[model samples]
Target: MLSQLMVLFGFFALVLVSIFWINKAVRMFDKLIGDGQPAWVFFEFTALTLPAVIGSMLPIAAFAAAVYVVHRLSADSELAVVQATGYSPWRLARAVVVFGLIVALMMSILAHLLIPNSLSQLRMREDEVSRNVTAQLLTAGEFLHPAPGVTFYTREITPEGELRDVFLSDRRNPGSAVTYTSSRAYLVQDPAGTRLVMVAGLAQNMQQSGQKLFTTHFEDFSHDISSLVSRDAINLNKLAFAGTPELLRDPQAVAARTGAAPGAVMAELHGRFTAALMCLVAALVGFATLLVGAFSRFGVWRQVLVAFGLLVGLKLIESAVLAPVLVTAALWPLLYLPSLGGLALAVGILWLAQRPGVWRRIANAIWPWWRRARGAGA
Candidate 1:
């Protein structure tokens, strides 16, 4: 439990750091868009998106954390006593499963519950903000700049559609300076569509020395303003939102919407299960590698690299090859073959870790593939 807690806290910190780095880059683009909001606004907006980030991060965090904890104990010579006492490698691996279960529960909550609800709320709040009235969008005392060439200042705005004093300057025009002020003004939307309709109690307009100024007050003035939203609509039925249960029950529906065959959902659903099961697989792989070779003495780094390589290879294959098969083989579980392969590999590794001479047989089969991987990486 303590290990689990440590890993969980470390994962959260990792996610926070990643989000901060992403925000640093996003803020630069947001500044160019001139949203009349501060950097903190973008920060808050980005921070609320952590639920989406949590799901993808969980598996990698679990794998890295498991490797880190296991290796650190070994490096400090803690595992030597356990091994000398006849604590089998399998028993040692069982301890890691305990931690894996904790991570799995956290992943399930983030993937199936928290993320979907948060995404729904985020979309709703975004819509509300975009539809907000012009008065709500404007600020008092400070010059509000929403675009490169537009500046707005309002002294006060009341809930009852009254503005105390207002000033607007449009600096986009080269030769002339257009300044407008009014004692009291109110804003309305275009009755026809999405446009701003401004109506004033009194008005004054000045232009650069083109014979005096024009004053108008009797009724209304109107202008067009763009809506303030950045992202596309967030629909919850995407593969990520379906969760494991939903995906299992309605593979057809998922296929239709996602344009993948039934195998895609089957693949993804099985993939998630397989991913959770990696705790067992990694433990097997790590233990097997460590036990067989006294001379080869492949340490923690080798164990980590082996696990990481296998995990990444499985993921890349699922994305690049199996993902496409989903569209062609909707009814059949073709995508699940990879998951089956992982399970098979795990079982084989466990068997070899127990039996004599199995490593030589497996090594002969696996060596060529290892060489290929090394070559590709180079």
Candidate 2:
């Protein structure tokens, strides 16, 4: 039993890592390339994204592994042999349940520790890349668009790294367009962030309706470059970024400190635990769904599809609950409804799987719909 559980778990974990890592690497390549980042940066960013991917993959992997293991056992006649040796279906499922618990614990650790840290690191790395790319745009002899609707050009770079001739266009502001031309300017990094300091510059402000261009000559002017950088949409006060203990502490206090919605924070706290606990339910559901049907020489592809469909339906229900609970924390308990419902459904399915009469009844009831689906496909 231990050997079967480990083999299935290891197989699923490997597949999970490969598929998700490749997917993330592809996406990260496009993003970093668009930002003019190096190849190493692309690899680094993709690598940092893996922990979060693995965390999300855990429950699904557990379910798939459980389904596959059960299918394999039934096919090999080992499960039948065990049953003939006086082991009940439920008794045979103990190792699978243990496997589910192991996965759940691993996912809990990720939800509480690794995922948040990795996500935070991704945020920091993205900011760093943005800052570097934005700063590099100040090179002489070429026009650069640091961000959409923001253009900058410098004619020359002094030994002291000052801009000899600077031209900037700001179209980010609605209802007006602004341009700055300076004989001398410099980039400054301060607590506020990167700023372009224009010395003896001409400011041109054009009104949209009238096309009236206003010119103002000034000795000193500054434009903020921080807005041009893409950043994580995460609110610092967001419950997603908080540690487990911090989240469990004073909800109101944490919300006050972060200037976030207390209800949202509280909802996030409970959601993490539910995320972990759902692994067991997912595994049970998959196993029970497959076990319901008679052993097939053709294999359990139909049963696999049914299990996958059930999983998707459960996730849809879970997503439906999040909307209301996130806004109204009083409904926070609704967050666990999908998992609880799945658990109860799994138990009923397991009981039916053990009883041929009940299983036959279910199969008989489902036959029409199954025939309809086959007919439609044909």
Candidate 3:
């Protein structure tokens, strides 16, 4: 129960930090696209973004938090007392790993299934907003930019789709601009249900060629623009798609990308295993490293420094390796290699710290070699 509570709190802290990080990115994107809404609306948007963030960061956060908690317990000599009472570190680590497994599986579900569906829904909502909105509600000027490239101006517009004094400038590129002016224009839908048609009573246009410009006029014209989206399910790209089950179902694709066998899907299939295993690895490393510096007594700040360095270094290497493995070899080295390495390092360090005779011999082997060189120089 205590371990579970710690994990829950750790997850909460990790989520808060992730959300704060995302808030910065969200504000920047909002400014870029001018999608700012009221405070309540922004809060809602952030809430929508949370599941995605949790899906991505939960495992790492769980690992880090587990490591920290274990280290703290060890530092306070709590582990020694527990062990005196016949509770082994490995046993505790098993519990941590179990917790990690649960979180990992939940994350996979969110990442693979929930997030994708939510994103598609959000897109559909935005599309509906853009499509059904009236030109007057969207723009109120002789010239208005509803979207980036299209410029529209109207002298008169009626609720019944009658548009008079319509002027449009399409600046899709440089050195060529198409200008259209119609005495009257209206929107019409095709019975085929394939397209929306814009019918015009009279139309005029000016086409530009370098420094030269040519103009033309017509009595009737029509225009059509494909809808923003058609009826199709969106695919979560390789990076964002989560869940080992789905990845396993399509083994050929994953194997082709990573050069690994279908069993490699276990990484995604058992994300919690990976995360909990990572926590155990980190706990072993953190405990041993802290003990090594115990006499020096560097304290929490020092532990924080070492932890930050180790975590950051591991992350950099993992990200660098993950791309190639997933892209070409189908080997997920990033997911497992660091975990293994951490575990090995932790075990080695713990053994060395516990066995003083072994440490002395190892120290002597290096010191004598250094002294021989100094003696010769003197």
Winning model by lDDT: 2
Clash pairs (backbone) in predicted model 3 = 101-272, 258-329, 258-330, 258-331, 259-329, 259-330
Ranking by lDDT: 2, 1, 3
TM-scores of the candidates in the order shown: 0.62, 0.73, 0.59
What is residue 233's positional error in candidate 1, in angstroms?
A: 11
The count of backbone overlaps in candidate 1 is 3
Give candidate 2 regions above 4 Å deviation: 133-135, 138-143, 147-150, 153-235, 361-378
Model 3 per-residue lDDT tens digits across residues 52-114:
666556545655565566566656777557756965445554655556556556655675677
Which one wins on TM-score? Answer: 2
Q: Could you give candidate 1's per-residue lDDT for residues 118-166 as a string of tens digits?
A: 6666666555555443633456666776545667677886877576677
Clash pairs (backbone) in predicted model 1? 261-326, 261-327, 262-330
Q: List candidate 1 segments past 4 Å from native.
A: 1-34, 37-44, 135-292, 295-299, 329-332, 353-378
lDDT of 2 by residue, 31-64 (tens): 6775557788888888788888888878888887
Please give the range of 10 consecutive residues that has the lowest summed lDDT in model 1. Answer: 288-297
Q: What TM value does model 1 have?
A: 0.62
